[model samples]
Target: MSTPKPGKIAAQFMAHKREMRLSPAWKALRGNDKLVLERIEEEHMAHGGSTDSLPVTFTDFQEWGVRRAAIAESIARVEALGFVECVERGRPSRAEHRFPAKYRLTYAHGPKVRVTDDWRKVVDAEDAQRRIDEALAELQARTAALSGKLKKSAKQRAEDRALQARNAA
Candidate 1:
C-alpha cells in the first residue's frame, strides 16, 4: 500500500464523504445508528484521521447523553449492515481508565463493493497513530507530575529542611 500524503488523504476523505452520503448501507441504517456514524465521521475529520477509520470514545457520545449499551447496539447495527467496523480495541490509561474503540467505515463496505488495499492502509495507519498518541499523552501526563515532584528549587528545599528542624527541636 502506498503512503498517501496529506493532500491525497484529504481527497480520499472527500470521496468518502460523497460515498457515505449516497451509500445504500448508510441509508439503511436506523436513526440512532446514522447519528452515531455521523458523529464518528465528524471525530475522524476533527482528529485528522483517515476517512476510512475513526477514533470514537464513549465520551465522544456522552454529549448526546446516550447510554453506553445503546451506543454499542447502534454500532453493532452499523457493523451488521457493513457500514462500519471496530478495527481496534482501545487500551485505557491507568490514571483515567477511559478507552474508546477505533472504527473503520467506507462506502466500499456497501454490498456492491469491497474495501481496497489502499483504503485499508489508511484506516490502519490512522488507528495506529491514534493508539500511539493516546499512549504518549498518558505517559506525558504521568511523567509531568513525577518531574514536578523531583525538581524542587533551592529555596523550597531549604524551607522544607528548616521546618523539619523546627519540628525536631
Candidate 2:
C-alpha cells in the first residue's frame, strides 16, 4: 500500500476532525483527542498553510502532483473511516450534493486562540518610531525619579524634618 501525498493527507485530517466534532462520541471522549487535533494542524501546515482555505479540494491535490488513483483511493478510505460524509450542499458538478465537502475544526476542547485587531491594523513606519520615542520618555522619567530619590520639594523636606524631630523626642 502506497502512502498518499501530503495534500491529500491534510484534507483527510481535516475531514476526520470535522466529523469528530459533530459526533456524540466526541463529547463522551472529553477531548482526550487533542493529540489528534495537533497532528492535523501539523500536517496541514506541512503542505504550506495560509489564511486562504481548509481541507484542500480535489483539484488542489491534482495541482500538487497527487496521482489520480491515490486521490480516489484515499477519498474512499477517508469516507470508510467515517471522516467524510454526504451532506446536502449545492456543488458545481453532478447532483446537487455530490462534491468533496468542506471541512471545519471547532477548538471546543481547549482555550481558544484569538487573532487580535492590533495584528490586523496597518501600522505606519512613522507611528512605530513614535511609539518607541514615547516609551523612551517614560523610561527616562522613571530613571530620574530613582536617581533623585534623596531630593524633595520644599514642602516635602519640611515635613520630613518635622517628623524626624518628633521621633527624636
Candidate with best lDDT: 1
Tens digit per residue, CA lDDT, model 2, 31-114: 212333343344345444432223444555555555544543443322222222213222345655446434323321212322
List, residue by residue over 12-109, the lDDT tens digit for candidate 1: 24235565445444455567776787777666556555355567887677665546656765766566555566788665556756666877764433
Model 2: residues with Cα > 4 Å off, grouped in runs: 1-55, 83-90, 93-100, 104-169
User: What TM-scores do the predictions have?
Assistant: 0.46, 0.25
In order, the Cα lDDT scores of the candidates are 0.59, 0.40
Clash number by candidate, in order: 0, 0
User: Candidate 1: worst 10 consecutive residues by lDDT?
Assistant: 116-125
**Candidate 2 worst ten-residue window by lDDT:** 113-122
After superposition on all C-alphas, the RMSD of every candidate to the true structure, in Å, is 14.4, 24.9
